[model samples]
Target: MSDGTAERTNEARGRRWRGRVGLSIQSKLLIMLLAVSLASSVIVGTIGFLNGRQSLHDSAIDQLITIRSMRAAEITTALDAVKRDASLHSRNLSAQALSTSINEGFAELQQEEPEPEDRAALETYYSDVFIPELEGRTGDSYGDEAFIPDSVAGQHLQAHFTTQNQDFDADYDTLLDDNDPGDGSSYAAASEQYGDYFSRLVREAGYEDALLMNLDGDIVFSAYKGVELGSNLMSGPYRETALASAYAEAIATNSVSTVVLTDFERWIPSLNVPTMWVISPVGNDSRITGAMAFQVSIDTINALTTGDEGWKEQGLGDTGEVYLVGRDDLMRSSSRILIEDPEVYEKRAVNGGIAPSIVKRAVEVDGTVLLQPVDTQAVEDAQAGESGTTTGRDYLGGDSVTAYAPLEVEGLDWVIIARIDSAEAFAPVSEFTRTVLLSLLGILLGVSLLSLLLAQVFTRPVHRLVGAVHRVAAGDLDVQVPQGSRDEFGDLGHAFNDMASSLRIKQELIDEQQVENEKLLHTLMPESVAAKYKKGDEAISEAHENVSVVFAELIGFDDYARGLSPEQEISHLNTLMRGFDEAAEKAGVEKVRTLRGGYLASSGLVVPRVDNVRRSVDFARNLLGVVERFNAQNGTSIGLRAGVDSGTVTSGLVARTTLAYDLWGDAVNLAYRVRSVTGDPGVYVSQTVYDRTREIFTYSEAGTVEAHGGTETVWKVA
Candidate 1:
């Protein structure tokens, strides 16, 4: 045959084969199954990822809140401890005796009258550091001699000794020699021993320095610096400053027990750092000899805020830390890495997008890190006395989750902030999502291949069974599918028929159970409240007009119950309360509840009535009558103390797992408070209740009664 005839014959053969079927139901079923499985996997995997991320984020916030609270508490406790120890030292007997000796020794040195350079140095410090501090300028650099580089204040005193050692050892010896040791009590340490005693105290106390201030505010002795002797904070350049306030508070008080603490300030010349002082009186009963002021150490605070092992040891992760910020938004403590290792810290600072000022301070290049701004949202809320967690930009300009709270210090507006990088907090969740997605993709591929092999056997029977299910789903449960096909799917249709029949009967039973549940709910709460709950309302409340509220307490019941077991005690209380409930129902009043204190009941709330006041009073009296009969029967002395008040009240169901029917307003509060008036066993009615039910119940004057709001005239019901 020719080529053209061969091509025509092959095309005809292909058409004949296609005519038998275009796409078989088996192949269609396979593709559809694969598509559905892949779609379901994608949807479920996405949901799991989102939910897991949220859970992890919430956990991070909770952890940060707990960490911040612990850090703040530690700071308060540590500072208070140090302050107490220093204050005690100032009142020591040896310290007081030494103060007198030091003052006298200085006075005698004045009589010696030499050392012009020593006089000049002290006078210069007074003018440079003290005056500038009073004017409120930065005090650190102002003292020309105070910040003479690589030296403390002691260097200025070396000039007076004519010694090149640049310290006060020689001058200290001269002062001790000049001192007239009248009692010979032996404070020879003031001379030869010099700063040995003060130095030991500073080292033990962990203070930056210690100063013995004479009544005139002269720096008579110092552990680190003693250059400002004869300079008075009261009438000199340091007047009107925090140290002056501490002095005035200590010396002006009559008690030798006086110890005053000053807030933080910049100590300008000697040490260019924030300073606090604890000044305590050193005196006998007649007069204060002098005062000992110790400079508070800031290193203790830095250590506490930064944690025991620099944040990580406290479960604060790589980016997590707790630090302090003042009201002015400046850092109160040094950064963790900054204090530990500055070179490494600077690299991190740059990578973290930390502020320029903070980087400068962290490396000690500019010393501005202590004053770096912390303007995050958590800090702002904390300054307003609110404690909570939030997600926002941190001081390092990174996305972070933060917990912040105000430190409970007496005179400081500092906030403690605990935070972690969001990327670090949510990394595990992201990894989980990636794993889930990969797993879903693998399962989808496997299922698609398996479905192709199995579809031929499943399609025809499944199609017939699907129609039967659709009818059942549409509420046509009586539709009988053909179970004629001899296969597992055909058997499935028969089981489905049985399931539908059982479901219809079960549904009828559920309807009946629902009605019973409704009835049960009405028994616990007011019917109106139950109705709202049935309508899917989470909370129910309303204002009622002219409701009479009765509050009654069982006196001596709690103390009496000490004689019984836990179960028996509860049983006894329930028996008495059940009697009160019966009395309320008989009088047409509604019993709200009986809790720890007493039973609170009301009238004209669930349903209004013009005689609610009358019903309330009758209910109170009947409850007491029930109590009396019980006392006589059981040989007990339980007494009923009741109060009746009629006015507008707010009633509602407290939305909890166990619902509480309650009332509030002046009427309810007054009724409860009046129960505490006296030990009588009668119902006490307010003036409003008296006017409404006076004719029905004979009443006697209960007189002006003291209640919660104020005293008001009440009456006794007979």
Candidate 2:
């Protein structure tokens, strides 16, 4: 085979293949509809499912936070209550001892006489012996100072010292006189009497531990076992400047002061370890003599977070566990199921110690004692002070939910953390979501199958109408669609058949009419131009340059129309414009605009095919030819005017719906003004228009006239 024959054979083969692979219109439409429906269903279902899951998760976390917060508050309240009871008991014990000492000193002073020297001597003895003895009996010490006995000891003691104006002087005299040999024997006797009173108060008040400390921060008395008298704490490592300052602050304000666990050594090795100290001042003769301190254990605090007594029966599942975590991010206590290690069961004295690794993970992971998975984002939020629940994987690789809350204890700043397995936390929600999705999927499948069956039943008759349309498009208008029922599809089938039958009968008539219309349009414009315009292309105007634009108007058309009937005026104007249309057609004008009495038309050398000044002049001259012809044909008194100018004018269809193409810029505007300024009924042309078209038309200078807004020279076409 030759090269040309081989190419033709290949082209034919390609065309056959394309035809075989192309989809039918109905098949394409069906596929598109199904795709849209499936995508919409999936998008909506997925969104709904995700929203439901998130809502459920948020609700669970909110409940967990509330429980943790309440637990922390309860723990703080209990600790405060213990401290208050201990404080009241210590204060009452010290008050009784002080009262007894004052009474004895007053009695001794009343038994002595008044004398200056004897009073001085008595005051010295009181300061050296009586006061020191009283303070020592209370487990407090007075500093050493020598005494000198004076003459008439008892007489001067009462007479001068008793009557002294100074309060300290009088107190000295009272101390010397009131040191009855019986009272100075031992404070044990006074303590025994007051001990019973304080014991009853402590029992009623429910104090766990209380201690009275002297001015030097020594323990004068203690209700707790093993803490002895004269246990100096002033120079202890735990009793630093900060502690002393805090103690002094309590005394100065006369209010309770608290100290949190500072170091591990200070903690007692016991199952229930105290973590806080509450201190208050003990007074004697309106002076701060010592301080009363109380130790409050935080074991109940840990229990509140991790206790499972009520929770286990609540059916939170076997995977769930609650535990307490301290500020060091260690577990302080654990729920029974989680407390497998000996360290956890032993209740190691962790009062002032760092939390262990397990507890630390619980606190750091979710800030809750209960171990559970948490949302990663929520965990990060809690780290920034939000104090909320989070879900994530646990050390055992199980899903877990965890919650954390800041415990603002009166003395201890710590965090409480709780966590439970996520599978357990969300078991109920998971079960619900699974059940709903399964049921929905089943219903969707059943409904889809039912819908497919119904669609096949209803589309049977419409299929015949669809066949007829396909046959018509394939050049078989004689085809008829079958009608089986009175439903919409059946009615559509009948309508299609009737339409095909009518088209068959009118086919010849339509062909003849279309041919005649095509010929008429070609007579009015070039066949190519008319065809392009009919197809809605403004290519001629769009590609044009240097076009001569023309404007025409009937000077009194509005008044003329007002004087005549609407029908008569329209008829007369149409008859008058017939010549202008013919003239423009002859001149190859691409477009025209008829606005009531005003007419706008443009053409030129400027259009796609022509680009010469002479062609523009020829086009304008033809317009003048049509105006003269119309005047001759009418022979009536009606006058006509036209104005023409040549310049760059951009022309194109301004809107898609309207097939009208318009000319713009100074040339079009100047042309309009030329027609406007014409004194009488005659064609006028601007200097630019005249210069371009003078050789083609007879014209004379119209002279310079101020055209509406400015002056410009124009010429008349006569």
Candidate 3:
């Protein structure tokens, strides 16, 4: 073809291509919106779903942890109460006098020979009864007691044993034979006096009984006259019980040592429920003589662990619960399942191969969980002294979310486990995600329909300006509106191009100005406080649990400025203040604000940290160095007095007409007060700060200063 013909044909093809492109862009606008909107909706939906699920899981775990903590505290308080009562009684003067008199009387009774008829009764009890029992228990140590069957019977007494959870009769005749504390008139008097106090112990102290034990772990006086009063836990049938362990632990501990708490066990005979013992050494100033053991009530424990409507009130959801587990793999509190439905729980236990003894109390006791065995990660790890959370099989053989921690009682190998069935725990999360997804789908469909209606209606008004509008949309903004249509469409095209250019310029200016303004605002206050202020926050305060605060006061600043020009003094003070600011910045500290001739700064206020105390100390010490340098270079007579304290503080902007950011609390006030005690010229730190820095920084205790309504110890930072 000729050149002219070919050029004409190419121009026609280009025109057709532009016409098709413009038509497609306007007609399929809804499809474009659908694709972009659906893409954005899906991304947002996925992120929100993940966050919601994780948040639910985290919140559940946190609630469980709090419940476990509360239960542990209640149990610890009960144990401490027992310890306190036992320790007080162990030091009782009347009790001590009675104990001494009983020992003396028992010694005297042993010296005298037994009466003929009493000896005859004791011999029959020993030879015919006690000796015959010994053949059955060949290795039993109590049966091998010296002064038994071979000699004349001294006296007969009753006692109980719990070596294997069975009752052993304490029928030894010590007075008729060799040397057990014999019954006498003086002994009876002392016993009578103690028995009166024993009645007081039971009635007033809320204990099951009160027994005064001798140094050899033998009960000397009993409030209830039980069989255990005369029984020796060391060699008697109760040798394998919690009492034996408690006595041994108390004996190992010194007289001034803290009380010992034994693990849970069934104190048979007199007590049938699971019992824990709190033991404290009984003595005067000389030595640890013996121990007084007190029984901890299981009812009080069950009240706390299963309180709040059996864990539901504790945020454990439907199948949630909190209970204690011991190292012996037994429950210290009742199972909610068994308490709620004993027969069903028993059936479940039997199916799971659990012994009948565990759920037996479920029927007898309405809510007691004692003596029931459990096997789960919460029990295993917590008993091993580990604190953790996990999703796994629970003791009742269901998937569960659990948090576990060891208890705080001494000598007790027990752990607290808080749990909820996983299905119930995550049901809310699943339901929320499903709801969100369904809502998003409906929104997509609705918006898609709206977009199509909009596309068809909106395209008609702009079809006359399509070619020009397409050119503008494709970034050819210099295209002019084809006039003769002096209408809104014409005006809209002109307005669109003009407004787009103006917006572009404004956004660029905003980007540049925001960066510079943010820096200035951050310099005026802290970055965190500035952000809150910019967001129109009226009251701004945050509690920081671990922060280090520094207060440096420039002593004699008024005197030094007296002889200088106003400008000169301002320049001089600025130099010193600037140096202090630089040092704080270098050491990663935040300069809070300046006071009259003083500077304030902090570490870990914006973000918490463990090393905030160390950071503050380094900054405070460097601040001292800055003052030292200033004095040497300028011949200034100014001295340094600075203080640091590490603890909780509330930091925020106090927008009182003129906005000023500051920190307040006991920690801050203490830091300011401690500055006065550092008149000798160095950084002085409070005990809290010193504690955090002692491992790395050398310090000397500078006694204490009256601050925070009390005397707080101060240390000189060397």
lDDT of 1 at 705: 74
RMSD list, candidates in order: 22.4, 31.2, 23.9
On residues 1-718, what C-alpha lDDT tens digit does candidate 2 reach at each position?
Answer: 9966974785565455445644554455568557756665676567756767778877777656666666667666766666665455435645546434433433344355544655454456547544454354333454322222222222322233222313432343232223222323233344344434434443454444445555655444444322122234555423453334445556566433322222111232111122445666665335555666554434444455545345555333455544444444434444443343434322331221324553444333233232322234433444355676768754333457877765565555455555667777777679768866776676567657766775786676665566668889898987865555534554466567668867887898899999899888665444555667788674644434577777776665566567789898888788757766776666677546776666677766324444334444455556556555655654434555667777776655455465445567777778777775745766778887677667777888776756547788888876
Q: Which of the numbered candidates is closest to the native, going by highest lDDT?
A: 1
TM-score of each: 0.50, 0.38, 0.48
**Model 3 bad stretches (over 4 Å):** 1-37, 40-47, 105-184, 248-258, 287-290, 308-310, 365-370, 444-718
lDDT of each: 0.70, 0.53, 0.69
Instruction: Please provide, for model 3 over 1-718, each residue's C-alpha lDDT reduced to its tens digit, 9 standing for 90 to 100.
Output: 9966974785565445444443344437657776877786878678776777789768767777787787778878866777777777776766666567655554454455655655455445444555455445432333323322221211422311111112234322111122223344566656555546656666677665555566766665555444354566777657788788778767777673547666667654343456767666667657755666666666667766777355666676667877887777878877777767787777777666677655555555554445566788678888788998989977767788888999887666778888888888778787877888787877778777877786576556576677766776786645655423334444465555455556567768989999998899877665777888889888987787888899999988899999999999999899999999899889999888987699998888875666888989899889888988999777687888888998888888786468887899878988987877746778899987877779999998777888757788999987
* Model 2 regions more than 4 Å off: 1-51, 93-191, 194-208, 227-230, 236-274, 306-309, 312-327, 331-389, 393-405, 444-718
Clashing pairs in 1: 139-268, 140-268, 361-369
lDDT tens digits by residue: candidate 1, 480-525: 6655543445446556756877878888999999999988987776
Candidate 1 vs. true structure, TM-score: 0.50
Ordered by TM-score, highest first, the candidates read: 1, 3, 2
